[model samples]
Target: MYTKELFHSWVPKVLQKIFLFVLAIPLLVGSSIYTANMGDMYSGLGTYAETLTFANYSSTIGMMVGLGVILKIKPRFKSKNIIVFAFISLGLLTLAIGSTQRIDIIVVCSVIMGFIKVFGMIELVVPIMFIVSPKGDRGEFYVVFYPLILGASQLVGFLTANLAYNLNWNAVYLMSAIILFGCALLCIALMHNKWTAKRMPIKGLDWFSIVSFTAACLLLNYILVFAKQQGWFYASMNLRLALAAFIICAALFIYRQRTAAIPFFSLAIFTKRRVLTAIVLFSLMGMFTATSSLQSALTSILQYDARTNATINLAMIPGIILGGFICAMWFKREGSTRSLLFIAFSCFLLNTICLYFLISPVVDIRYFILPTFAKGLGMALVYISGGFYFASSLKPTELMGAYPVVIGIRSFIGTAFFSAVFSWGLYQFQSDSMMELANGMDTMDAWVQARGGGMQLYASVRTQSTLIAVKELFGYTALAGILVLVYILLHPFHHLHRRQLIIRRKRLKGESIDGLRAESFDGKDITATAASVST
Candidate 1:
């Protein structure tokens, strides 16, 4: 969100740009490092759900709070100084996570790290948003930013995963801390806060909504992540607390938002069909078509080590770069929002089909190339088109509200919560498949035959069951892609047909067609204007 003017007095152009770049890099690095090392962390902790939930839930809450803080609070120090503090804090916490063996300690450190990470990320971008000239190649900068971080994360993850393999899990995190320390140093050296927002006292702040929402998110995340492993109703005391807390906090959150003088969430945002649609599309894409799920499938089922899997995943980087370029060019040239959406959906559909055909327990690494590439392309197209569409739909001042709501809901909660759902489904499917296979082996000979002559029979069955479960998951993902494709296709039809109907009414009224002109929504005319909206 751009302020009416630069937040504080302008600085030298080159120095300001440099500060923005330096400030921006750390948050991406911290995020990438954490994700890259998650597998090792999970192994050390010895539970997938618990490890992931513990690592992610805090970060999500922190981001949500940071979003609010950025909008509400104007710090006394320059934005860059706040970022420097956060970077130092993050570096220390990362080191702590590396050194600590106790899960409880790790969890506490993670929460603290999350708080810092949010401030780091929010402050990191402050200069870019507030100081940089709006006329600069901002679109191009963003076009490069997303794919670069994504590809670099994969590369860094590969390297750290290798470190984990050769040395230890601690080695992976130690490297991360060292790298973060370097980043902190860079921030300290290069970043200067020449510009700062005027300090404003936060007025009419709904503390209850903030508390309720935070509690709801944390509790619900735990409940969702652990429910399958811990059992639904009767397994663990933590589970009971998670469920009760989630329900009570969630209700309170909703009520507080409704009653607050300034609601934390404006329910009015959902009234805009396009905004709501974009959120749904992005959320589903984040969930069912998640790259993390695919990575887990490669490692856990196909038994490819992280290094090899990462190399296979390199195929995606090219696609991401190409897709971002194409999307940017299209927006600059044709500027067809509808067409961009169609392209995104088409790529997603192609990715799903490619994956459906490619997935198998014994599938070769080469088989992943096309599908991953397609997904990367689809991801870029969706983010570029969907992001532009969402931002443009709102008034410029509404950007702050949009950022937290969209990013928090679609990226953080959507990814973590859906990944949990997928994990739970995979476990259920594996269990059911294993049971079916075991039951079908009725006779001794049949059992022996099915078990491959009693040499690691159960292990063999588990592997097969896991493979089956993954395939079923892919099938479901394909179905979701189809639904998205249909939705994207149909959404634009109403607007196009309505325009045509208006044109016909003007003609019927004997209005001059030659002099009648209308502004295009994007740069492109609706190609499907002749098609009936109802169809």
Candidate 2:
């Protein structure tokens, strides 16, 4: 009802801050909800493998496109104004996705929704960075913001699933749209026009690079998602197309980056060992947080309904919030980030190990609480510390070009690859277990069961196979965790102790360690001894 100019001039400071917070809430939550409840969407769209694959692949492609656009545009408009339009776009897309019964239509809507969601997410942060004054003690506010968004998204994602299941599934999307629309109005009312930053001119955008990179990303994602279904490399047309597209586009993209005056990505900063280390950490974080297999185990083997699953996800938030708080406090106290990462990885190892033992068809939901909480805590700690570590590793100029590619790999590629691996593992384990069980069956008992076979036999076999597969997945994850833990200890902590001891012994004889200062991945100077570099 209010004009933007009139409302911005008259709004109170307290009310404007409240509006800012409100606007932030919806940006990331829908994307989380879509991801967390994908199985539900799979069911709603009639449980076709091809449909789910295309829907997911299309959505991710759209996200890459949107990310490209965001990176290209830089900061041109009012941040709040960008958010307002983004939310409205999301609302419309959500409604369109929910209203459709046809899988094809839903897939189209999802792609658009993904595109809009990415745009919304990137824009959402711009306003906060611009408007929120991080002076003196308030400097930690910026550090805490992403985790806050993450926690909220997790909570809302679960709640959205619960709502979708209890009422009509479509209702959740419609209600979300209405809520976002209301938030958009509030943004118009509260955000002022005076806050403007110098934006990079749009003319500098590398369109060719954007297109090539997006094509490569999309093709790669499609292959990852659909390779098993398409029989991998030789059989499916999809795989063939994906491979050809990916190879060509990737080569072109690389060539452009090397040659262009204004490349879409500046790969030179990645020459730093610390930046590469952060990328590895971020990728691992994505792999660790790929919870789809775990959720599938709960739903398929343990028979948890949507509401119960939602409740379990909801329980994870408190632990995540606690971890974030701990990290923030530790950072303020000048606690070592390397130590925090060790603690985080240790927690992750614990979570994976616990889940490895605790998962079974007969296990109750209560058994998952501790392990899930640990997972959440570890995730938050890694995310918070890792963000700080990555930021500190770079100069201010390096931040812009470095983040998009690193995050693209971390966010999309890491999860997609792990999910594919998990799915393949499940299929392989299930098939092998079924074969083993079949071979060991008693002849007379098998004959009787075969003679009386119906829903009961099928259900029993499915449940058993699924249980075996899930347990195998947990075990595999635990083994992977062990490897990660060994890496963490060796690279970050264990080696540092040896270096320190060598330095101490050398200093006792008045050795000159003054020329030994080297840049460490933890954003500190390490006395680089001969032994340090060799290791």
Candidate 3:
């Protein structure tokens, strides 16, 4: 073992904790900054819109892949040292992305960056959880964690947008690189090089599953993102080929998972009813949240610049904070996960309804504040509660294996899949609306001629069609939200019985009543207990 002192003995432990907390912010923000500032990148990088989505997909898939192997990788190096390496790697990758115009290079860099970024995050997150909840109370930790991640992301998006607006999109990447490099230096200065666990050889990892799953996801992403541009599956040979490749890769991944001696993800977790329900809910949440992409359409139609659109999104921060607060309180009180989900879906439904009416060619930014708040609130609730629901369903032995799947569905696969579907739906709706409007435009031609002639008529038709398509999409999402909300309401309340059983079992084991109560109340506690069991 190597011992290297970094922070002086005089540095207070509280200050060290603060340093860890601060170090975590950049790691979380850096992962999704590019996706958050998509519009600016589209204009500045001069890449096809699908290229941005592909980059995002690649990064997300990379993160998912990284997470699958994190436990196996962690014991190999000192936590601080690995984090510093990740920071340096991310810094270089950020610069690489900024310096490149090649779409393929951008995507490849994003994948590597995403993979490296998660190591830094996991190193920081475990420590932060301890700091936030010294006694290992996960509710307290989540109260801080959800708001910090969600709110900081929003704030970073706004700041990056401002940076892009004032100085070009490349400036955002430069700024991220500088911040990452700065974090590396800070980590070196503020932390000692020490291993948290015994050094174990990296072994038994299923690399085949990782590669196959990544290929499968990327191929599916390509098909979805390019489906509209390529004229759907039948119209484009590339789409057909991508679909076939995706099918083959997916099959290979599943086969390996089923047969491997030590699979990347254990197939048994899917047998849990609560886990399956969580997956479905997560998919719906992704679809509902994906509608936020349409907000860009509203902004574009209204001619809002990148800064203005970002400013509008800033309205979501307060609601995110509020949602976090509510979730924390709910968890502390041992509230029903079903009830929490109902509230979450209700927020989504409300947001959808608000946007359904609010999207139009002529609309003020102020009109978006409510819907944006609701969207943020819904996102926070779903994220926190959905994770709890999923984690609570499994034993500790299964958690590390299942966690990557949960994150993959919640953050990447589900969101990306719906985003593509919505994109295609929007395109079809816009085209159909335009054709219908154009067919009726002869009566307005004379009127249009009196105003600004053919150009004005075309612009008017285009704007109206976009607004109509967006509204129609929102209307459909609203209906889906309603159905989901109803399902949540009708879902049986079995969690209470399960909690009672846990409490009884703990009592029978002669555990402290207070500890049993605390442990049985929150899924995060279950997760922590599970982690302890696995370790």
Candidate 4:
């Protein structure tokens, strides 16, 4: 009986803070579970590089539609408060799905994870944030609680990722299942909710948007999964898949949204320029940092074993926490977002320097730990600040639409594009280096003439040779970081304009005379509490 509404009614300070900490636990644990599962999820699909790309694509699309489907289905449920109950109820199912690795199982888990995210983490933060302090003290909450919880989550996740890399990939899934179940238990024991939204019945389904969305996602997934094995357009299957998917998506989106009662996506949210920019920036940064392929650099180029690779990432905990802590303080005192971003960029540069010069078989784990921390520091700066950025920019009324779209698009598009770009680069260098080594090899003729068992011997040589050639490919990541830096500096705001905008988002509150958050789509009138935004 005591849930979101009960927590909201009259929970006292000491109890509320305890519940909020408990609320944060599942999220932290969930993130760790997610990162760990991802570390091995695609191991069976392809090479380390290919596996990384496939996992990114699958996870992104699964996440995007998970919310879309939930939004559509939730309004149709008859039970009052079903939104809250429906989300939390799926916990064990998530455990089951995560624990199993069959495509069917993983697919199920991804869908559920996406489904629960809306009412679970996103909304919970709002209440916990508002209740944690007096109505006016937003900046302090961000400075203190936000970083601590986020750092805790990412640290656990970072630890899990490394541990999985060393253990069997299957261990990742099992661990995630255990963690998720534990979180569910903790939720029942400790979480206090303060839900106010009434349940909505699904009047009509957005069949058009749904089809379009599915087709678009499926098409993209096909491209990622089978592209290497089948070859791009040369594979008749790829061409057929692309053609079929694009047509369905194009035709369905136009035919349905103009006519449906509840459209899956509102076209209106993109109208806000600042919000749009923020979305793009957020996506790019995530794509740049989190792709599983980055692990290849640590494992392959650095010539470190899985255990060592995991250890290097473990070192990131302090820096990640430090960066978030610093940014929150910066936001409270100076209210300067640009300064926060500038700090992120500077740390990024230092990280790139670490990679540019230091990647070698001779390089010890100690050498890279600082660099890892520096990179993490950059991530911490942008990430913690970004949460505040979204809360401030969008009113509560528009929250679901604005927050999900920004998070969804940024993650999906950024992941797909970056994975494609980085993999292509890795492939090209890998191909070239192998060819060069093969041409120079003294045993080339004999290797080519070998049969059956001889072919196996040749394969081993090829594997070893290819690993050696990947040195050039490893160097490309540092270059990619440089490219990202250049692009960020080129943004029109560069520094001063961005600084002012961050302050403006926080300062103006309701003064945004344009009714900036007033726009509505999908029938919900979205608005944010000044208190909520400040938090």
The local distance difference test score of each candidate is 0.66, 0.68, 0.80, 0.55
Give TM-scores for every candidate, taking all chains together and pairing residue i with residue i.
0.84, 0.85, 0.91, 0.74
- For model 1 the local lDDT of residue 37 reads 51
What candidate 2 gets wrong by more than 4 Å, as runs, is 1-7, 47-81, 102-124, 127-133, 136-139, 193-195, 198-201, 442-458, 492-502, 506-535
Best by lDDT: 3
Candidate 2 lowest-lDDT run of ten: 526-535
RMSD of each: 6.2, 6.1, 5.2, 8.0
Better of 1 and 2 by TM-score: 2
On lDDT, the stronger of 1 and 4 is 1
Candidate 1 TM-score over all chains jointly: 0.84
Off by over 4 Å in 1: 1-19, 46-49, 129-133, 136-141, 191-195, 201-205, 233-241, 439-443, 446-452, 492-499, 502-513, 524-535
Provide the lDDT at 187 for model 4: 49
| Best-matching candidate per TM-score | 3
**Residue lDDT tens for model 2, 1-535:** 2232213756776666566567767766565135555667667767655456556656666666666566556456555566677778877777777777777677677667777776566554544554543342222543467567768877777777777787756777788888878877776666655434455556677879877886787678778878777777778887897799899999999999899998876779788766777888878877677655565665666777766776777667877888868876775566666688878877777777777787666778887788778877887887777766665556545665676666666666777788778877888888988777667554457664676654555566767887778777877787887788778766653135556666677789898877555333332332111111000
User: Candidate 2, overall lDDT?
Assistant: 0.68
lDDT of 3 by residue, 33-148 (tens): 35556777877677678888878877877888887888888778887789899999999988988888888888899889888888888777777776677676555677688878
Residue 7, model 4: Cα distance from true site in angstroms = 4.8
**In model 3, how many backbone clashes occur?**
1
